[model samples]
Target: MLSEGWAKVYITVEGDSGDIERCCEKKDSHMEDLSLQYVNLEESENLERHRTEGFSSSKALVVRRGAPFRVSLQLEDRTFHPKTDFLRIKVMLGSLYVIIPVTSSKKVSSSSWNAYIDPEGLNLQSPSIFICSPASASVGCYRFQLCVFTQESQKAYAIGKFILLCNPWCREDAVYVPFEDQREEYVQNDSGLLFMGTPMNLVSRPWSFDQYEPGVLEACLNLLQVSPWHQKNTRLDYLNRNNPVYISRVVSAMINSEDDLGVLKGNWSDDFKQGVHPSMWTGSGDILKQWAQSGYSPVKYGQCWVFAAVMCTVMRVLGIPCRVVTNFNSAHDTNANLVIEEYYTETGQKLNVSKDSIWNFHVWVECYMTRRDLGPGMDGWQVLDPTPQERSGGEFCCGPAPVKAIKDRRIDLLYDIPFVYAEVNADVLSVIVSKGRVISYSKDTEKVGSLILTKAIGFPIHQSITGDYKHIKSPTSSLTSRRSTMSGDSTLSRAGSSNGVSVSLTLDRAQVAGEPVCFTVKVINRQNVAKKMKVHFNAQAKEYNHGPSDAFWETHGVIKLAPMEAKVVHQQILPAEYAHVLGDNLINLAVVVEDMDSQERVLASEEFNIASPHLTVQVADSIVPNKVQTASVSFTNPFSHPVSGVLTVAGAGLIQGKVNFRVLSLCPGGRMEQHITFVPSMVGTKMLQASLSLTNISSTIRGFKMVSVHGA
Candidate 1:
């Protein structure tokens, strides 16, 4: 018989690692000795567990490694003696397990995990203790159990599960991020910007990461549980979960369904009746929830940006700092030759002769972590793409490809560093073909990686990070700081091999949707004699990722240029001629010159994006939590005809779920204003987003406003 009102609790974990078991086994004997003479363990209470772990106001029990979190233990029997009874905690993930003694006298290795009874824990009817996992603990869902060991007997009680993740806030963690502000923005901010459109006409589109939302964290954990890596080899996956490198690669693969039963099914075709269009998605919450609730079946549609943004959410939810990045003129070299070959006719018409592609802007995520697998100095931001463009290690996922290796051209490293290097550094080989033969060809080494953009820290604007990817200096316009993708001045030029004639294309200015396609073709003759040439000007509508379709507009004319003469021919294609053919709001404009005498053809082409009309989201600068706040959405029809569609509004901390309503019809250039109200439930800087999607037009307009919420 022992003292009353005392209960001993212990948590035990199962694992194949004998080192952990030996460490835990040695501590258990010490704990048994402490039971012979009891000791009261106490620790200072911390109310900011959720805040410090960046999961405040979130529903899941997500704590970072090396951080302590509390678990309340309720006992059915209370008549136990403190000297003869104690507690043990058991936590298990896959085959790795450990049994932790909560008493301070049995303190185990600080390099692993530790537990302590927080002040009279065993003396009370309901015991509350602090569980602290070492910085090296594997990241995943851990099954927590509390077992009572009394002098007479021992019994185990099962409790709920908690998730452990990498700790960017812990100095001892491998994923540690030193700065407080960057940690907040990268790991905590729920919304951000995704740069799209062309480098000349950048679009700062908004995206809701929805990482802190309820069920999102759960879904992220569930995602890992359902991944092929975890399903095929749980032991290896669980053991490697401690390394961010392996976790990121698995997550990148899980973001698409081509290789496994993953979260999203990528759709790049025209028909989307079976599922939602890629452009209609405003946030990752709906996509992730749909994936989890539907028996892990992949969600309908997602593109590069959506995949990257969703991966960002998963990385952030797992406590790894992440951000979405866009590369203008991103190349996809099909043959691994480090060059993308493009063929065009003498009449400025693109020929589908190569497997290569150049996306106007390709989006992916950059996760911040130390790359122990790739050696030192390689640590920092590593590019991870979930678009399923290429398969690495026989799986449809790419990278943790170190950005440092990319800049230094160190392709002999692990992951997909070579693939990523070619994406930004590939040479563009433009060939002119006439009569089933190559007339002339030109290579542009600097064209593929013209711009790389990411959202600035603590601000909604985007800044150029191009220099980080490419070591060499860029063109004149590449260095200018960009707040909005609104500005432009990039030029395009290609010529015949050492010929006397040259052709170049330049945009008078950035072209916008619903406006005429405007640009000029300059032809120069350096020969000492006059020459007559036939000019072929062509315009074709294209997706940012695919090659140009049939030419929507074309013209042929004769021009005469004397020696030391330069000519600029202005061209325009009306909105009526192009709006119907646009599938992805992008166009390929080209002009080819055929020397009437020499028959040598020269080509110059420029790919430009027809930017969508901006959707305006406005709300009060400061909103009170738990109080109703009004937000307004404004949009003007940029088409030639009346347009109508659905308008969706979403917010993380500002609104629950999402609100959708039918938008009234609006004529060309007609403006529509909508107001909606919702009561916020949390305090912080939150994004209020509205998206206007149309069924007829191929463009989606989006807007987001970041507002500070006042605490109640």
Candidate 2:
């Protein structure tokens, strides 16, 4: 039972009179001044022996709402005994506060603090306490004051002011059921995903969200447009506010392009023309902190991988279960026609007419939730894409598309299952056009969405679930009958070949900025007599949309091949030759072979990208909020001529304003370094993203450094 002195302090204030009375009472109390210390339970086994001051002066103690918290405290004055002394905790938020009387035993009461005080310690004057936040406690930051009152002294002393932040997680949110062995992995561990390059069977790189980092929950609340500390609305507002629709709407809007703070733009050429690697990113918390600190500006440049990774972080921080999945050979079926068409000229030069395109790989996030909105079997995993490519309900976002609906080809379902269905199952048509007429074309069903993958829970291995979505047979309805027939027949009849002569082309590897582009063309002659053929080769650089930009090199030659002979024609392009024509590091190369006597032609073409050097920024591993820090930006020229550019450095809490540096003449292969200094305004994970844009080259290279900041 609480003593009378502590009981008199537990008053429930409601109106203006209560506020006036509490203020007058605080001023009248002649309490002794004593320093309060917090015990470091994580670092020390004995709570009484290891203790530090509780305040912003040290790292904040973070815990989720409803989670048990243990804190051992010691008073500066050894005259106070824990057994006889009464302690009261006051939690203050703005003008309102809650008073809970600390007790030696756990007692059930609305105002009673259910805590256990251990008096038997190395220092008998110090006491270790166990406290638990009520399940209904709102998520936010609060200032708490602990005071001790002695019956002999008949006075209460103010010990210290501590900051307590309630995270967004509750027991109801921990409903994610993983496999028996993976139960601990999904709930307590972080997942991983690979990015940047072509999809491979390699293990995904590990990433930690570190949701416990200070200000993470607040930043997440900001993303959801919820006030962290103040509660104008109750938990029951809008079906508990944590419902699927509310969560989806918040996440969708936060990641979509309509809001720049969404962090990613689907347009690849705008920012990635110079070269940005998604794999280089550290983790989601780093990206989010950087965005939050930058005042919600889109983080320089990001593609599908970056969007998915950051979305995963936001969802996990909000107590939602999330995982990043990658689809290899993903099809962007812009028209919802269930077919992506590619056009090529007679000489195999790819035409830029078709809006459809196939990405080497595309990544997106899957969130686990029970969808009462859709009802029934749709209550499992829902797909959500942060990349703003398609518009959903006039907004640039996609999903909460139910995975079950996508697998069953239920395109009529809510959200954007149709778009996702095309991404994983669309047939790719390769068409050859000459003189405004279609000459030859072939459709390949297996090319797009070859393998759908996600990391195995608790394991560093690739898990293939391609068969799950691919098991459904082609739709036989009248609407899709013609298109389905075209796909089946096109596979049986290979286009671009006639008279038993076949031509094939292959690139040595993806071209780099300073390296030569080399490819081989193979032609088989099945005729009994010698044959004369004309070979036409062409190379051009084009934008990601397949729009032709410049024709770099073209040549024609005649070759005589004997009967039953197979000839391989090799072409090598020097760096100096294509450097001036390649605008965005992407090139479309084509090769064609013609049998002059029969007027038959065979064509082959390929598209590849060249890599550019990245602008690197280096800063300290850990930064202190409100303290000045210096960062260095390094850039290397990978071109033949001198490049002039502007380097811009910006961050949210790390810098006050954007910092810029101008380079007049950075010679090719020359390295340049610049330094910038700024003070951080808030504590948590911070990002310093820098970009260098060439004035003459129309290109931009970007890089970022993520650092943790301790509260001052």
TM-score of each: 0.89, 0.62
Clashing pairs in 2: 293-652, 294-652
Candidate 2 minimal-lDDT segment of 10 residues: 47-56
Largest lDDT belongs to which candidate?
1
Per-residue error for 431 in candidate 1, Å, reads: 0.7
Which candidate has the highest TM-score of all?
Answer: 1
Off by over 4 Å in 1: 1-47, 50-60, 72-85, 105-110, 119-128, 150-153, 474-498
Please provide, for model 2 over 1-712, each residue's C-alpha lDDT reduced to its tens digit, 9 standing for 90 to 100.
5322121122233345443333222333444533343332331222111111111123333444344456656445553455455666556544445666676665433222355565345354456666655543533345555554454332232322333322223333323344533333333333353433232212234454434344555566566543211134533432244254456545765664454346544545544554344434445655666667877666656667777877776666554567778876688998889999888777767767877888766788887766777768887678898887877776677888888898888888888998999999999887777789876666667657666777676554666656555663444321133223223322122224556576666666555666787877778787787889998888887653345555678888888889989888888999888877644445667777878887677776555666556778899876897778888999888888899988887765566556789987989889999999989775655556777777776566666666667876
Q: What is the C-alpha lDDT profile of model 1 across 175-227, one tens digit per residue?
A: 88999888988988889999988877788878889887777888998888988
